[model samples]
Structure formats: structure tokens, C-alpha cells
Target chain A: MHNASTASTTEAATVPETTSSVDSYFADHPTPPFLDNYKDRIQDLLDFHASSPRPIVLITSGGTTVPLETQTVRFIDNFSAGTRGATSAEHFIAQGYVVIFLHRRFSLLPYSRHYSHSTHCFLDFMRPSEDGKNIQVVDEYRPEMLQVLTRYREAQSKRRLLLLDFVTVSEYLHCLRASALLLAPLGPRVMYYLAAAVSDFFIPTKEMAQHKIQSGDGSLSLTMTQVPKFLSILVHSWATSSYIVSFKLETDPKMLLPKAQQALARYGHQVVVANLLHTRKERVVLISPVASTEYTSNPQYSSHTIDLAPGTEEIEEPLVEELVHRHEDWQSTSSS
Target chain B: MHNASTASTTEAATVPETTSSVDSYFADHPTPPFLDNYKDRIQDLLDFHASSPRPIVLITSGGTTVPLETQTVRFIDNFSAGTRGATSAEHFIAQGYVVIFLHRRFSLLPYSRHYSHSTHCFLDFMRPSEDGKNIQVVDEYRPEMLQVLTRYREAQSKRRLLLLDFVTVSEYLHCLRASALLLAPLGPRVMYYLAAAVSDFFIPTKEMAQHKIQSGDGSLSLTMTQVPKFLSILVHSWATSSYIVSFKLETDPKMLLPKAQQALARYGHQVVVANLLHTRKERVVLISPVASTEYTSNPQYSSHTIDLAPGTEEIEEPLVEELVHRHEDWQSTSSS
Candidate 1:
């Protein structure tokens, strides 16, 4: 499935390097305050898992926002609920992997995803005693609730899962960079599952309005420059040994495979999990680089499709399982 | 309190009529499908409360998004967690008022606001028995949780609170218009508490991209037309006899009062609750029209400040009380 022309075309689209250099982008944007606090927390987490045989997975989830003003009244936001990342994190945890969840503030998390953002309140799950002295989960939900609660408690007690949060794209980049650099020492034991829907464009702070954009001005015109492509730098420079997986979400079905292949070729990442927006939960195509042999002519890359019956199965279960297997292969090959 | 000059200046900025007329805006934008379903629900709700003495208040909460494309991948979003609207809904319920909570989808709700969207998950507040047979709220949070549970249960049992949600500005406007028209029969007994942070600008459907906007085209420039000022029409036509209250939120402290006053003058709405972004949770100014008797000129309109000693009080409590008092006065005056 390696379409060279399409891949090269998409490379230009995905990596609009004319906007700003990677180094300048980092230098120009101020590091978020939370990075300093997360440094201590992430270090503590890594230290706790230092001697454990379990692989450590960093799952970045949700959507990053681009502020339009200095004192932001409004922002440009990507559309995502973090379902893929949250669901996948739970699978990784179940498979005996230590998890570091870096998510958008108030977006879904692994254990809490089931109840938090639903139309029905969490209180709806509770049933009061006849005497009104005690409360318990309703009969219908108790089984699943108890299971989730037990696993959550186990993870918390063992400190196998660490949580971090970000609001804006700047914060997300800073945190991601800091985390990747920290996780670099872990080498083959680390996996970077980047599922966050990072913004493609952003209004530079200097170009943004100091106050709210007033409506009296005939029409409001916003000029936003393309955000620097950090995936290339992340793969080549930061945590180069870690097995990295990035998602390519496309609304147009025709563009999905090509864009995924292009992202794989351009970024030189280990895997590109490609899915169409409408059927993302039901099916996904995992595209990765395939090694070439001297005697035979083989495809430069391979694509494997994972399909789940809608409503009957969670695709993340199979997706994570496949990735874990591939990660193991990657680890063994890298070590040799 | 009502500075005429400032009010006029704000009127020009607030209602940018140069973009489109109210009639044209409605004609151009397609109606949201939920409006038809909500019409029946609203009628049923009104029928249920036909004989009740409790006042009915429609509270619009949270922020609306402006989609960038027809099949939206990205959107411009306002900054709001629905704190004011959710907090005020609880107060209105406590004050013997029938509540209709119209809010942003997945934003905070009244009782759920306390636990949902917190840094800690709701599971953290629960404890499972040693044998893992039973689960209950932890000792520290039981009191408040029990109180909130009781009130929520009562509201559910009585059908005193109704919930409706919208994500985009188009959906919000369509729903708001339909609800206002349906509630007009209630006359002076009805109140409109509009606390939602709506987008001032929107890229019209005709102008929006059909698919996701590509980033390869150097810098992206967005030209957005002003959203029509519907408040004026809502007050004068849709729900003429209802006591209308709108919010004016500004990042600039100096622009806050003037904009609030201008909104009041331009819309001829009953009240304008003005607050600055940083100090909003602690203090707000309520501005309203004063009767001009032939005898004396009482400054045209009056402004009353509501301040909560931070961390000690919920501003919504006193703010709701003051609004309730003013609503009672409005009803009496209208009838007389």
C-alpha cells in the first residue's frame, strides 16, 4: 500500500515547514507552567516502574485547543472525545503495562470514561437503602461498576498509572517533549501511543488580539500559520528507540490510506493507525514499514486491517493487542 | 449607573447589522432537528406545570461552537464550563422554581457539577467494603453527596427540571428561538436567564469548506461575519412578556459595565448581568431599567452590585435571590 506519489504529496501537506522551523517554534512558544510540576510527577512514576518487568506506555489523548487571544475568550478546537486513547489505555493496563495518561483537561480517562461524559449523571447509577442510610450502585450497573472500581483501585494502590493534563496545544507540545525526553532512557521498554488530535494551525501569540475580537469590524479575519510538524523531530531526535504509534484520522475515505502511508514515510515512525472518522470505532488499518531483502522484490510497507462488529466489540481491545505484539517484535529486533 | 454614551457605543459594536438581518439569518441557516422533538417535550412540561404556583425559568448555560466546515473537523469555541448557569439552576430549583436547563452538550449540570469534570474521578469518592460486596460514598463527602442526592431525587421524581442541549451556535439559536416562542404563553411568570457565552462571529454555511481544511496552503485566513443580535427580537417579539436577563462577559475590566449597559439599551431587555472574566465568580453587576416618572429623573436605570467573599460563598445564591426579587417586581408591574 505504499503509494509514492500520494505519499510525497501528503508529505508537503502534512509538513508545511515554510511556516517555522522546529527549533524556532519551540523557542518562540513559551513553555507551559504545568511542565515543571509534571516533571516531578513523571520522574516519580518512572522511578516506581524502574525495576518492574512490565512495559510502560504513554497514551496521549483528547484534542488540543489554539487560543485566538492573549486573554482567550475563544479558541480553535479539534473535535475528539478521546474515546480511542482512553479505551486503548485500559486495554494496555489490562495487558500488564504501566500507563502514563496525558490527556486534555476534563476529557475522558481510562476507568472514568464509562460514566463521566454521559447524558445521565453518575448519581443516576446509585440506589439508596430503604432506610436512606446508605447508597450502592443500582442492580443493573453494579456488576460492571464493581469490576471497573476494583481495577481502578488496584492501579491506584500499585501506582502503575500516572495522570497528566493539558488544555492548549502549546501545553501539549511542552508536556510531550518533556515526557519523551524523560522516557528516552527506558529505550525498548517504552511505547509512545500518540492519540491526541493536535491542532494543525495556530495564531501566534504576537499576532493574536490583546482583547476580545470586537464584532463592529465589518468581518473578523484571522490569519493562522501552520503549526510546526514535531512528529518528524520526535521520531528522529527524541526517544528514537521507543516504539511510536500515531493516528491518521480522515473524514474522506479515499484519502485515509494515502495520508497514513505518507505520514509513515515522512515521519519515519514505527506505525500509523489510519481510520476514517465515521467508522473509526469499527475498523482501522495499521500501516508500518516493512524491511526489504536483497534477493527478492517486496513491498516497502505493509498494511493490516482490524475490524470489529459495531456495538458488539470494542476495536481498541484488538488494536492494543496487535500493537503489543508488534512492540515486542520491535523490541527484540532493536536489541539484536 | 447607566452611562448613555457608553451604552450607545456598545450598541454599535454589539449589533453589527451590516452583516445580515435577523430574518435573512433564519432563512439562510437550516433548523436543527432537535427543535421538533423539544417542541413536544416543552409542551408536555408546560402542561405538567399548568396548575403549579412555582415560577418557570429557562436557563441557557455554557458556550457555543462555530463550525469551520460543513462536515466539521474543527470549530471556534468560547471559554465556559457552565458554572454560572448550572449553579443558578440549582438555586432556582431551591427557590421553588420550575427549571429548564438549556446547555452545551457534555458541559456541567446542576448536581453533577460538583463531581463531574473534576481532577479526581467520582470513583475516588466511593469506598468498596472489605469483602468487595458493597460500595458507599466515603465518610468525608457523604454529607454533601447525600444532600445533593436527595434534592436531585426529588427533582427527578417531580419532573421539576428539564434538560436540553446544543453544541453549535446554529443549534443553540434554533432551540432558543423555538423554546422562547413556546414559553410566550406563560407571559410575565416566565424568566429567561441567558448565561451562555455565545460566539459573536460565524462562518456562514455557504462559505464554509465542505470537508476538512487542508494546511498545505501556507497560512489560513478566516473571514467571519457577525452573528445577528437575536436578543432584541427575543425580548420584543418571541417572549415579550417574560422577564429577560442576559450576560455581558468581558476580559477588559473597563469594557465590562459599558458593554452591559449598552446591551441593555440596545435590546431593551429587563436586566444585564455584567462581569469581568477573572472576577466573574466573585462579583457581578445587575443593571436594569428604572421607570421614568414625570416628577423626578432617577438616573434612567439602576445598577446593583452582587459580591461574594471568595471561597466563602457561592455568588449564584445571592444573584439568584436578587434576580427572583426583580422578576417578581417585573411581573407585578406588567400586570398593573
Candidate 2:
């Protein structure tokens, strides 16, 4: 298998740095048109829990697209099913946390994830009643449907979850910044779970074609600019006192730990959940920084791997429990 | 609006001709690995309809992807909802034509299309019964669900529909050829409805990166070759005796009729259904070649526009009726 860390580090030296600073990137790109409409809803959600003790989490899911044209008949897309974020949100909701799910427009969501994109059409679970005037769930599928329905209805009635959507990398970045600034007031009680597979390169709006790219040319060549990394800005500027968790996905097993540790040291974030592409659903390693000793000035690193339990179908349950403990610990110490 | 026909025409003159022949394109690209399995199913369907007078139609829907890497972390995609093909397939089935639905995986499908991928999640349609032990569709939605369920069950029991899927342009082309040749023996009794939004450019497998493309470099440039046009080959070589209908989608109102007429002249195909991108669901113009007189030397062109009726919802119903009539006319005259 290819070693992802080696490839990335080796390439970094030979390439001239063209990564834009976050400030310049925002100045160059326009904010999404719908951001204004979302602001009021976001403010209302934040205000609803302002005086309560419930921890608010912003979970970003799915993959962002890099459009090659302004009109976008064609674009480059990253591979992601958005399972990690969706599953994690469900676990958090069950544990009494308010979730703000910012995801790709049509990617999976928490409760509905069980049925929407499954192998069998949702209708397959239904049958006409004896009179043929009503529809009822098949006997074999009734229990599961009722359980999921109950939870979905409870979530809806409680109004504990907020759903937001984006499609392009530009919109994602703008939404992230706006959200981080809005959540900054929550301090240690807020968590930013950045699980979205964001694109690392994009074609600037000014440089893109107004119409669809024509294919009559013998060979079509596209030059895309490097997307700026914003973890540092989020840590030091946007949400300095809030807990932050990011993900690192690599195909090489050997690169998982080191790359994750490197991210913790570089970004000064609280946690990095690392996993290999093929084995992601079964296991993940959480890497974080800890104090070495009571008197020591330097911090030590800790890595813990969580595996799917013998009887469980998903690893997200255990993963979320672990994070909640760490978040609680952070809150107690920070407040003290 | 920008004229699509003019843009394509003016670009063709300035660019070097690099379009490949059908034989070479197929020779260069390997067929999908699963083709062997589908061949048996294709044969079974063909055998079942051999003695019956029922007409068989192959409807290709959805958009094809162009992968940039062999492992496929990134790919260029064409935008399509696959509504036209899915809606038309339902109408064809209702009109007594056996359907072979060749669609992109996860795109819309007949019967299931009404529920999946809609604004409300499929779960929104269901609720717990009075005892809370069973699930039932909401009273308001039960009637529509029962109607769709009836048609779906009928189609399933009759074995009149076969679903096949593809993702990449390469796979689509290979599948198209295999299907056309397999259906060739049916002669004029078959119809090929090509509504897929196929990519015009693709990176050859041999030339693509073995792993995910690195974004550490300052600027990434990708060069893609033009995909060989396969309509002429489909008309003349693959299924010469089959009735064929293709679609032309354009943004310019002025180009809708002329470009469609030009396609009929160039490809020697039976019909081209043309529509503007914004108003495609509301209206379409069917352009076909007709014998002008009993002693005419050349075929004359006929253009008929179909608009959504005041009370009706879908344009596909009327569109399919028109094509069925045309297919019947062609069959009667050719056999005579």
C-alpha cells in the first residue's frame, strides 16, 4: 500500500507554497447567498440553550465539491458517505447534547440514515391494508420502524437539532467561519466536531468558465489553487475556548498515528480521531495531548484505539461516550 | 442566453480534430468486470420476449462520472436528476412495453422515485399505530402510496422490468454496446431511449494516478481526452434495425430545434427530443426524420412540441404516448 504521510511530506518540500491565508481566501471568495437566512435560525437555536447546561455541538458532515465552472456541468468530488458524522450526531443526541448538523445537501442525516439510502426501497417495507385503502408496515419490519419513528418524533418535538446544508467548498468554508464565531460565546460548553471531508484544492470563482466547459478541444487541462487550512484560525481566533475535534483519514495503516499526532501538535486542537479508509467503520484511534506531570511545563501525548464491541453494529456509540467524558473533564478543569 | 449550438460549432473549427473511432475506443478500454453476470440476465429477458408481440425498450438514464484516479478519491461528474428517464420508464411500462432500465446507481428509479430523494425523508410518511406496536402511513399519504405500490407490485410480478446500473463513462459505453447487440435479433420490435447525460471528456485508466491525487503541490492541473461519440455507431452498427430515440439538452432557446434537427441529420437516427435546461420538465420538442412523399429522394424533418397540460403534473406521460405511436407506425410500415 502507498504510504500517505511519506507522499505528502515529500511533495511539500519541492512545491512552491501557494496556500492562501484564511483572511485572503475569505476576501477573494464571496459568501454563499443563503448564509443570511441561516443566521437567524442559528441565533435562535443558540439562544434556546444559552442558559442551560447542555453542551452544544456543531457537526459538519459529507464531502465538499470543487466546481470547475461557474455554471458547473462538471466538478471534482471527494468520496464520502457521511456515515461518521451522521452516526456520531445520533449518539450525541441520545446522550442529551444539542446538535447543529451542517452537512452536504443530500448526504445522510441521523435518524433517517437507517432507511433513506438503504438497499431496499422504503416502500418495500410497506404493504396495503386488507381493504387496499391504507398502507401499513410489513410485520417483519414494524418494530424497527416504530423505534426509529419514536426517536425522530421526539427529536422533532424537542427541537434539539438544527439542520443546515452546503454543496461547494466555498460555501463550506464560509459557513464554518460564521458558525465558529457564533458558537464562541459558549466557551468550554461547545464542541466543534469537524468530520467533513473538505477538498484540498479548488478553482477560484474569477478563473472559472461562465458556461459549461467545452470538450471540442483535443485535451482539456484544469489548474486548481490549493485550499487554505483553517484549523489554526479556528483554534486561535474563532472558537478559542471551545473543545475541538478533527479527523484524519489515510489509506496507509502505518501513517495513521503519526499524522494524527502531527495535527494535534500543529493545530493545538483537543482531539484528532484517525482511521484508515478501509477499516474506518470497525476501529479508530483518538490522539490527544495531556499534561506529563503536575510540575512539568511540557505536555505528553495519549492515543487510545476504540474497536466495535462484540455485539454492537457501530463504533460511534463508544466513540461518542469517550468524547463526552473528555469534554466533561475539560469543562470542570477550565471552569475551576 | 448563450447559444449552445454556436459555441460547440465555433469551437470545433478552431480545435484540432481528436475524436476517436468506436472500434479503437472499445479496444482501448476494458469492459466492466460484472458484464458476464449481466449478459445472462440480458439473454433471459430477450428470450422471454422473443415469441411475444410485446415491445422491449432499453432506457438509459442518469449521469456518468470521469475518475481522476484509479482508487477514485476524486472524480468529475455530470449533473442529472435522472427524472426524465425514470418518469418515462413508468409511462412505458403502463403502455405495455417491457423495460430494461439502464441507470446510474442510486439515481431515481420508477415507482420508488416518488418517495426517495424527496424534500421530506421517507420516514416522514410513517407513524406508529394507536397501540404503538405497528407502523402505518399517514392518512393523507396512504392513497398515493397505495397507487404506487400497486403498479410496482404488478411490474414485479410480470417480470417486465430489468434494472442495470453503471457509474463511469467507460462502464456505460461497454454496457450500451453489450445491450444493443444482445437486443439486435429483436429487429424493429425494440426501442433504444438514450437519455443519459454522458460525460464528454475522461482520463484514460492507464494515465490516471494509482492512488488519491496529492494536493500538497501549489497548483494541480489535469488533462483529459475527449470521449468518442457513440450515437452513430449505435444507429448503424450495434442495432441497425432497432427504433432509436435520443435526447438533446441545451440552455439556449434558439438552439433547441436547430441543434436537434442537426443531430438527426448527422447521426441518421429516428428522433431527437430537445429541451431547454430550465424548462425541461415543462416542455420539449420532438424532432424526427419523415418521408416527405411517396417518391421523395430524401427524408424531411418534422418537429412537434409537447407542453405540460393545465391539470397534469408530468410531461413524460404525453411524451411517451407520442413515441409509442411513432414506434407502432414504424413497426407496421417496416414489416409490410
Best by DockQ: 1
TM-score for each model: 0.93, 0.89
lDDT of 1 by residue, B1-336 (tens): 121222224423234233347777877788987789988999999999899867999999999999998888899999999999999999999998999999999899998888898988988998787888777789899878878888888988888899999999989988899999999888889999999999989998899998888876878999999888877667656877788899998999888877877676566667899998899989999987664511122225688999996666699999999999988977777778
Candidate No. with top lDDT: 1
The lowest-lDDT stretch of 10 consecutive residues in candidate 1 chain B is B1-10
Model 1 chain A lDDT-worst window of ten: A1-10
Interface RMSD of each: 1.2, 1.5
The top-ranked prediction according to TM-score is 1
For candidate 2, the TM-score is 0.89
Worst 10 residues of 2 chain A by lDDT: A1-10
lDDT for A53 (candidate 2): 91
Per-prediction DockQ comes to: 0.72, 0.62
